[model samples]
Target: MSASLLAILVTSVLLAAVARRYDLSSLLFLVVAGLTVGLIPGADHISGIELDPDLVLYVLLPPLLWSAGLESSYVSLRENTRSIGLLAIGLPLATTAAVGFVAYRTVPELTLAAAFVLGAIVAPPDAVSASAVGRRLGLPRRTMTLLGGESLLNDATALTAYKVALAAAIGASTSLRAGLETFLVAALAGVLVGFALGKIVVFIRSRLDDPLAESAIGLVAPFLIYLVAEQVEGSGVLAVVVAALIAGQRHSTAGYAARLQDRAVWKAVQLVLESFAFLMIGLQLPAAVEGLKGTSAALIVTSALAVFATVIAVRLAWVYAFAYLPRLVPRIRSTEPPPVPGQVFVVSWAGMRGVVSLAAAFGVPLTTLSGQLFPGRPQLIFLTFVVVVGTLLLHGLTLPWLIRRLDGLGDQQRADLLAAAAAQDRAAQAAADRLDELLSDASTDVDARAADVLRAWNQRRRQTAWERIDDEGVESPMATFRELRLEMLAAERRAFLADRDLGRIDDEVLRAMLYGLDLEEAVLNRG
Candidate 1:
């Protein structure tokens, strides 16, 4: 097991590094790595590895979700709430219904319930893919923000609907009324559970004296949030997301060391787990196709294509309606600006299915209540796998091209920069005003050195935007000072290495000196 993990880590790191350099899809590269490595003869140690659906849902998903929620902008999400709501809830429902209907029609052997299950599985676009590609392409802030927020929340909707459909498929009674009630109750309870857990985590972190221990609590927070919600039969996905959002907002109040520890640990965790999950997906091909030797290749291909089309078509139609329909109403039109058509098309095509769909596919039960094999179980898995591959390849690879071709890049980012500059200008002026008030006061305690540093920071912050726009673009004095400090640190680093090579300093002493130089360099370089 350790060897297998080491092998996966090495492969993921190599592919991820190459992808980063070339600006290719890292997630796709990982998938390719998995598939390519699977082809190697006598590599059963990795190709033979198996993953359970519960292991994915329970063990892997929470942390990934938490990291996403923590990084996302709460204020930006709130601003795009209407559009996000339509995409998250309405779009998934439409895709599920359309795909389910197509599946039922294309494969006569599939029952409506089974078709719906497959539909639910493929409904939500992968959050990892959207953010990874969107951010790299320098997408407008609003478009990227919308994609991030929608991907973060849509899992709850799709997964809840998946359960309801699965229950029906398994011979349990299901109704529109009961399904709606269950969805509402589960969603509300999940939020409440997350809110409660968020507070608990905050309290725990406050009491923990060690930064590592506090970071550990942050790491486990997602799991606790998810498990607690699941224990009460609520939506675990939402629980993790809500708790993460709350915890992230409170992070500002945390000790600097605790925050640094949490960020460092979570960064490593995200890379390791997310890479493994995507790679593990490709490794599932052999298992996904098991018990299907008798199935016709043609049937699988046709059904997969049908399902894929349904997923893509429904997304485009829904986004079009949502984007344009509001413009026709006076009140709505005045409230929110309609989206650019080109950008709308890009967002619609960004709906690439990923790990969540595959996990849910493997989770499908083999038998119903009557001890009979579940209808179309193998076909369902095959079709699910196909949709993931199809969308990931088709939409994921091409969205960047379409954005460039259509000139769909919006000005949200430019506007945001302008707003940020204005805000910074005001902040700097306020600090200046306060400093004046302090200097004017007869009885006020002020440290000269500290006050000078504070004043410099305020001035630098205010001038940064203006300096960037100037033709010369020369570095500020503060920046130049930091650059010189970095050079001095590098000199120290070289001297330590030279002493170690001459045997004047032991390896341990050299390492300790290097560490100090590194920390000092970090501050200067970061500045």
Candidate 2:
């Protein structure tokens, strides 16, 4: 394999192993690993070391955002629309202005317009990082929904504002009419592309029965939507977000086989892609730092501190202000829980810049319209990198502790209530055992066997419940059983490999058998 592909494969597996062993986030490990490798002598000179900003922005970010969007539930987002809107749109703009004002005042050489442009580039929190950490930390469902939804919308807003600011910096007047028209066109085109792609994917899914092939198709859908939208001058991020939402909604309603295939494929793809993207982020650090060699450390520090504080303070202010707006409206107020101060704080703290910011910072033109070298281009990129690293490390590391300190830990009473409800459902199955037995007798042999299995399961389940009630505890024996099963599976896999090597089984047969074993292992682990 080529070096780039090989590096990706090796780094992905290593990151996974590291994440599994440590309590750290996988993205953190990947970033560290990439940075470590890049700093090695001669590593930066590798033939495949290209870090094209456009490729990262256009090719990488859309799918990453789309994946988060697809996994998000629209029902929840709709209920939290007020909070999402406040954070995504209002906060980003506020932050841009705040940062612009600070930058213009702090740096005499940089114009107000240029400050806004820089602020816009760094305003949106990274959807990928937030989702990755939020889900793992067991953050409230509403919080996760807000973060994901906000990132999706904020990216487009930030990019739009950046363009406007950049145009103004080049001495071009802002035409309100033209700006509105462009925004509408971009939004319309993205929606059209998304719906069109969604329909085509749905059609293909309906026609295809093979799980593997269908899963492969689903993997390509996000990239396809993003690229097509970009080509048409629409918002690629919006297109991917819309396409993913449509695809996910359709998948939920799809037949069992298609849904199963989609779940398996998406789970695998998400793991691989998330790991690779974060690793690349880490690896790019050396180049980013090198670009800043001649810049004064004081200047870089001042800019980083100013931009970071501006982004954070503005988000906090906006979220606090508008989180209660739904209540004022009366009608929408009753639909969802009013976000408390704590929830608003969580939303504000999650605004950690990542791949998109890096891409946008690097994507700034090398030269201005007047052919002057984009002033402070290297310094801007370097400072942006500093902000990304600082926010991700500082907030990402402290967030869990902060949540706990704020008493935002998962609610034990709610968990117990859910568990009790599940136990009651099991009890109901236990009560229906006799009825099931009678029904099974009148059915076919397969039904009879299935019924017998369920009856035994019901009996065991009831016994466990009684034991739990009597002893006030229930021990999980499934863990021991799983370990034993895994050992047996490993032995069987080894035996099969030996057979294939000895010419006792064909390659196709061995592959099929291995695939079955792997699927069984996954199911067992889940159980």
Candidate 3:
């Protein structure tokens, strides 16, 4: 294998192992590992292995973002729409303005347009990073929906604004009216294209008998919609979002087989894509640092801190102001869900930058309208890298601790409610069991065989009884069964490890065995 490929494989394994052991986000480990590798003499070659930014952005991001959007419950999003709107649309604009003002003032050589470009590049939070961390933290579904929705919409808005800013930097005059008109047209065009493409895919999916082939189409849908949308000068982000949403909605409603296959395929695809994205993110750090050569360390540090502070401060202000202000008023309050202050705070802090920002920053044109090199391109890229890494590490590491401190731990009441519901379901099963038995004992026994099977199921569904117990009660049959399963798992793991150490079983075989054992243990514990 080529060194780059080898590096990726080795780094991936190492990061995965470390992340699992330490209970850390895999993204964090992947990035840190990439940086370490990049610092090595020959590792810079890995940075030179470039792919097209458009391919990564328009092609890759849409599916990933769309997947996140599809997974988001529309009901939750509707509940938090106002807060999401304020954060996604309102916060980005506010942050851009704040950063633009500061950048233009601090860097006298940089034009106002250039300042805005910088702001726009850093404005949108990364949906992938936020989702990965948030899910692990057990954030409320509404909070996840708001964060996902905001991140999805903001990418398009920020990118659009960035384009305008870039044009202005090259001395192209832009009218607000023209910008608005363009945005509306582009958004509408994207929606139309997305719907059209989605319908075609849905038609194909419906007719396709093979689950694998149908899933393959679903995987390719985002890239296809994105490319088509971009060709028509539409919002590729919006197109992808709409396409994924349409596919997900139609996925289950289409039929049982389509739903089963699509769900399985999409879940696997999501895991692979997410892993690749984060690993790539880690590998880019050395390149970013190298791009900052000759720039004053102090200046870069100051600018990064200033930009980070501006981004965070602006978001906090926007969330608090917009989300709470409506509640204080009677007239507009009727329209929206009352924002949860804690959730808003969490969302504000979850603004970690990732692939989109990196791609956009790097995609900054090398030459202006007059063919002059774009001013401060390298510095801008480096600063953007700083913000992405800083926020990811800082927030990702501290978030769990913060949740605990804020008493955002798993809600016991919610868990209890679910448990109670489960108990009620068990009771219903018991009643159904007696009914089946009564019927089974009767002379009219045409479905007696089915009833017998139903009774067996009810026996399995018996309600778990919890009672104050002495030592005798503590060592129940279930507990004894669990102890035996644990012993079996330990023995199996030992055998696998011993074989692996002796080279009789390869790592893959060993890993598979261990995974199987782990799964069995999980099932046993659940029982």
lDDT of each: 0.83, 0.72, 0.73
Residue 209, model 3: Cα distance from true site in angstroms: 3.6
Give RMSD to native, each candidate. 3.3, 4.4, 5.9
Q: For candidate 3, lDDT tens digit of each residue in 71-112? A: 766566667676677877778777778988877766544677
**Against the true structure, what is each candidate's TM-score?**
0.89, 0.83, 0.80
- Kindly report which residue pairs in candidate 1 clash with one another: none
**Candidate achieving higher TM-score, 2 or 3:** 2
lDDT, model 1: 0.83
Task: Find the candidate with the highest lDDT and give its number.
Answer: 1
lDDT of 3: 0.73
- TM-score for candidate 3, residues paired by index: 0.80
* 1 versus 3: better lDDT goes to: 1
lDDT of 2 at 337: 65
- Put down candidate 1 lDDT per residue, 1-527, tens digits, no spaces: 77886787677777777887897778887887777666777877887576667778887899999989888888999899989999998888888899999999887667999999999999989867877766656678888888888888899999999999999999999899989988998999999999899888878888777998888788888988899999998999999988888888878888877887788888889877777777877776766777578878888778878888888889989988889988898998898866877778878888888888989998989899888898888888878878887788788788867776777585554555677778879988998999979977889878889789988877876776454343456677656766777888888888889999999999999888887787667655541
Worst 10 residues of 1 by lDDT: 464-473
Runs of candidate 1 with Cα error greater than 4 angstroms are 1-6, 41-45, 207-210, 411-421, 434-458, 468-482, 492-527
Question: Given candidate 1, what's the lDDT at residue 268?
Answer: 84
Report the C-alpha displacement of residue 448, candidate 1, in angstroms.
6.5
